[model samples]
Target chain A: MSPADRFARLPDLLAADSDLQRRGRWVTVDCRVDVGDQPFFLALENGALAAFERGTRLMRSSAFTVGATDEAWTQHWQPVPAPGWHDLFALTKRGVASMEGDFRPLLQNLQFFKDLLALPRRLPERI
Target chain B: MAPVLDPMIGRYLRLQIDGVDHRVYFEEAGRGIPLVCLHTAGADGRQYRHLLADPAVTSRFRVLAFDMPWHGKSTPPDGWEKSEYRLTTASYTAAIRAFCKAMELDKPVVMGCSIGGRIVLNLAIAHAAEFRALIALEAADFQQPWYDTAWLHRPDVHGGEACAALVSGLIAPQSPPVSRHETLWMYMQGGPGVFKGDLYFYRVDGDLREKVKSIDTKVCPLYLLTGEYDFSCTSEDTLRTAAQIPGVEVQIMKHVGHFPMSEHPAKFREYILPILEKIS
Candidate 1:
């Protein structure tokens, strides 16, 4: 899938997840996901997704950034990621993924971020 | 304010335990019966810092807290990489036995929290005659379904940050900001792979459901205390485990989580003093 196409599907996938909505109910944070060179930003308000945009430049403030190489992103989006690709932290720990900026929000709402990122994993492989 | 009673701080000692030289860091305070304290997973002897400094508790008993091998100020044994720094029950038990023996602590009251808490049960069951009593905080027979270490154990996963984030959730919501930060800081400083190694003992290799019944209360009376907000080892989980072991006493601390001694020492002390009175 094209980067834009993949980014466009995140909002719908996030919205449809009842567990994510419920667990993220109290969370409100701006998160950026950088897949290879393609960057996407998501704004979560009160545990619900508020906005999503595809761009390299972070126009607005962001709480944290989760970035990874194309190969790493591909493996992470797999139905069942291999050992090192299974978690964002795992990817970061393995030196394949990079996380920067404030960590409080990501740590505080860890489950939400974990579930949110895993959404693409649940998507059909073709998409 | 009451004058603080100074604890007898001991220097870090390099002791030969389980046949390898291990740098065991420990501290001691107070005067009477020995109370050997164990720390949580990924953490060190500092978890019991408040206990060692508390005047009320120390005056009545000599409190000792030591870093497990490869944790805090303690160094892992030679050729530790062979095991990838994993903590097995056999290794944990051997260390505890060696620590007690080296200190010449005669039948000390063994008190531990989390991983420390879980090991006291093993100590009581396997070597009951060595301890005068056992005080286990936030301990359970098993922690399946509630916690998972698969992601943390991934070779690429940075065990320190991942484990710190994972444990941060288990802290009580009402814990003081300073207490919470300090508790998280302790986990952050843990050696790489050490936390996952310890969890191997806590979550996997430390299954004691069948073995607990063999614990002779007469040899070492058991007291179980769990924090109200410790989701990993909930009060209900501890209570359930307590029920299976005859003569096991149980209490649940309010406004505390997994790291009771570090997260809320005053409240933890309130719960502990009463138990000590009965046991000591």
Candidate 2:
């Protein structure tokens, strides 16, 4: 499928996924420029592990990840995958900016982060 | 290891006190009435590096500094013992008494930073006759028995690497570098059980303000100080605390936070030294 088609279809896929649910508002993307053969971006809220790697491919490491509480999050010292994930997440969730990132990884691991976006929907089923 | 004494300081000592028998780590420089300085939580006595370096500070008095037990080179208490105060506070107060007797100090002026400050407050309340004067930096009153029960059961606020990372961010300049050992030491010195115990008992007890009013000390010049961003106490709260103690003096170090001694040394000395000279 074309990159545009994948981008356009993600919302529907999230809505349809049994194992996912949309949380907060729009999802965030991190595009790692350097690190290894593939660079991945992660999304987070309150410094909890969200999802990442829109431009690269890697197998699912875990089905779901948790985030730290607001206090713990404030104490988190590790740098995030991308530079602007926090601010961008805030802006995009508030409808201030469009979701934007490079296209290479989205074409590679399109399914996972999209599933991540669909995470909120699956919560009732999981519980 | 002999601490790498900063040339800024003159003579240093490693002595063992009689009552406690625990190592008392101290450094002395310049001369006048002696000022005994205690470090804040999660730090050694050496934190006074900048305070000792100031020309103005050295001119007025002899500064003697020591690390609390389980901090710096001092050893931890061998066994648990109940007292009027919590474990950490008790050892520190005992150490102060022992330090005084060993040195034959005649009510030497005393100053403490953060938890160290809290210890001095407790000392003044219990042994008011021993200190010529007292000053505390961001010291919270734990004697009134205030505590947060909810937090007592939770994991150490600094439980793991994430917590250590957070601390590194707070004291990055003081922290040498990132390593598991350093992180673990931070958590240990910021004692897992005792740290929470002190906080829980002190926060919920609710009578610390009143207790401060009754301390029968020499009206021994008492000064309460904190930085602009102190997490433990706000300027408003610390000032209110000072007001509760009849003769307590108060000062706020600007452009710094909880660890004012490390973050704003020159200002820390600027405020504390003169008080030592006056008392000495």
Residues B173-193, candidate 2: write the lDDT tens digits: 222333323433443455434
Cα lDDT for residue B255, model 2? 48
Query: Where in model 1 is the C-alpha error above 4 Å?
Result: A1-127, B1-8, B145-147, B153-157
Candidate 1 C-alpha lDDT tens digits along A55-116: 76636778899888888878877775554455565566557888788866775567567767
lDDT per model vs. reference: 0.80, 0.50
Model 2 per-residue lDDT at B82? 46
What alpha-carbon RMSD in Å does predicted model 1 have with respect to the real structure?
11.6
User: Which one is best on lDDT?
Assistant: 1
Residues A20-60, candidate 2: write the lDDT tens digits: 34332332434332111223344443223344444545653
Q: What is the TM-score of chain B in candidate 1?
A: 0.93
**Residue B271, candidate 1: alpha-carbon lDDT:** 94
DockQ of 1: 0.05
For model 1, the docking class works out as: incorrect
Please report, as a residue range, the 10-residue window in candidate 1 chain B with the lowest summed lDDT: B144-153
Give one clash count per candidate, in the order shown: 1, 28
